[model samples]
Target chain A: MAETGTSAARSDAWGVWGGNPPRNRGRQPGELETDQLTIAGEQLPSRLILGTGGATSHAALEAAIRASGTGLVTVALRRLDPGAPSLLDVVERCGVRVLPNTAGCYTATEAVRLAHLAREAFDTAWVKLEVIGDEETLLPDAVELVTAAERLVEDGFTVLPYTTDDPIIAQRLADAGCAAVMPLGAPIGSGLGIRNPHNIALIRQKVTVPVILDAGIGTASDAALAMELGCDGVLLASAVTRAEHPARMAEAMRLAVDAGRLAHAAGRIPRRLYATASSPTGGLPW
Target chain B: MQLVVNAVTADVDDAATIADVVRDLAGIAEPRGVAVALNGAVVPKASWAETRPADGDTIDVLTAVQGG
Candidate 1:
């Protein structure tokens, strides 16, 4: 595949990895300088993927996108409202790849059709496939999702499916040729955080492809926890866009993703019921 | 001819093609980043000029918007 003009700059921005030469030297084992987030042969600079949704204005959204340092952002397809500000223009100006989504589709067929439309509109075969089962919960219809993912994959799309936390479903999506499986930490926009970290870890273990935690991130810590739980990346919208200060929150989320990834790479200490003294107990007088 | 564009019924010229609908009816002067769906199938940009909607056909003219 031909590299986009931004690829070189993006690789530089990422420091190392993703076909870029190693920049960090003399580093301790398990200490990473930077790990590029690669999905479907595309090496993304930042692990943080922003969704251009719920922002007060395009200016605010652009600021958040720039602050987040995301190399990829998601946009949804909708009926063209004449004279409305173009989200594509703003995203293009920010210099990030667009991952157009089938956000409001309810069935596999609908999602498939929408994905085709996105491919034409965006001029990219990458799609964030979302097939909602219910209106109230906005949870994915697993069966429909898998079906759509299969169809999209067969159609030559680099499919990234939004799925449930079930490890089996994650594996199914990966087996169906999805480039990545985006398991929701909780319901979309609930901001409840990762309700089931164990399941997320299980999904991570189940799939060899990239595992991105999508939805239900209330703050930076939630994104950190997702990374800590073994998610390859984090995809969020309302957590930052809906915050009191979108840019500040975006920056915080960016740092949190990096910190959590480093912590995960560094390997944390094991938990125990009994407390262990950090200082020398033998030398301390009672 | 009449067409159902984005669920809105509108009367258009008989020879109006998908390009005309996208430009004139949808009010999108620059159709670079826009896509059109005739009935239910996507009409590619190159074919949009030749693809005409019959009476009562549903034309969905779509563009990118802020969403997750």
Candidate 2:
């Protein structure tokens, strides 16, 4: 992975992602120590995963994806013209791995079938499992999500389930042998931006697998915040695709993710209700 | 026999398999990156040659599209 110099963003932050080593030995800094994120043993240099949806045009989508520096991009299955240029064409031109999602599925059967179809179509076993319970909020049905995950795992697919922020569902997904648990920060496309950080933190703390903040991200700050809260990655689409300037927003998201990872490793100071002195108390300037 | 493919009506042979229908619609000898579902259930590629769709069946042929 090429170094982005983002590790130097914070002076107090330890050397992270191949910048410099910490001065002290045996003292851990924070969660991330490297630039690579491993999911199902696939090492990726990028922590920001982009989805190929909601872009106004294929040109914008291609440009934004390339600018984001995302290693993994998602595509969905639908009834499309076989003659038209495919989304995979864009993903391939970008030179990134494809993560197929069962986006419109509402049951385990449909999701499982779609997973199988995706595997055959992409010749890949990595699936982003999404079993939405209803059409209103598009919240995942925890039970169906876990069931589809287990089925896919048994079928030799790397299942990455899109679940709720509830830690219990996260644990269920982990227990079902998922590659990772992607908890929504809020409803899809709501741009709510991590409504319950506490729950996300709890899921991160409990699950042994990587925790990815998947949805409800409105801007770069939301992605950075997810990383700061100890998430392994952020998967977003509309936050960048729907922006006024998609390529620029994509760049911002990339920098934000890197900065957030750096801040997490640098070890943030403890929060206090009272003011603390940054300058010496004995300073004569007073 | 008549069949509905992606909401379009088409005429097919009574003994035509799903593979034949796909070939007719997609204009490919052996289609790649496409999946077929008959009556809401996916028809595996291996079985496409033998799985015949009944008259007036809804055949949904789906492929990868840009999505979040």
Highest-DockQ candidate: 1
Per-candidate clashes come to: 0, 0
- Looking at model 1 chain A, report the run of 10 residues with the lowest lDDT sum: A16-25
lDDT of 1 by residue, A1-286 (tens): 1112334565577542222233244456434434788898878989999998898889888888887889899999999888897787888798999999999999999999999999999899999999999999999999999999999999999999999999999999999999999999999989999999999999999899999999999999999999998889999999988988787678789888987887788799999999998887686566
**How well does candidate 1 match the true structure in TM-score terms?**
0.90
In order, the Cα lDDT scores of the candidates are: 0.88, 0.87
Can you give the lDDT of residue A224 in candidate 2?
A: 97
Model 2, residue A149: displacement in angstroms?
1.8
TM-score of chain A for the candidates in order shown: 0.89, 0.88
Candidate 2 chain A: minimum summed lDDT over ten consecutive residues — where?
A15-24
TM-score of chain B of 1: 0.88
DockQ score of each predicted structure, in the order shown = 0.77, 0.61
- Residues A1-286, candidate 2: write the lDDT tens digits: 2223343454256433322334234445543445578999989868999988898878888888877889899999988586777777788788999899999999999999999888877789999999999999999998888888999999999999999999998998899899999999999999999999999999999999999999999999999999999999999999989988787678788878877887887899999999999888895965
| Tens digits of per-residue lDDT for model 1, B1-68 | 88999889999999998888888855655575788899989999999888878999999989999997
RMSD vs true structure, all candidates: 6.7, 6.2
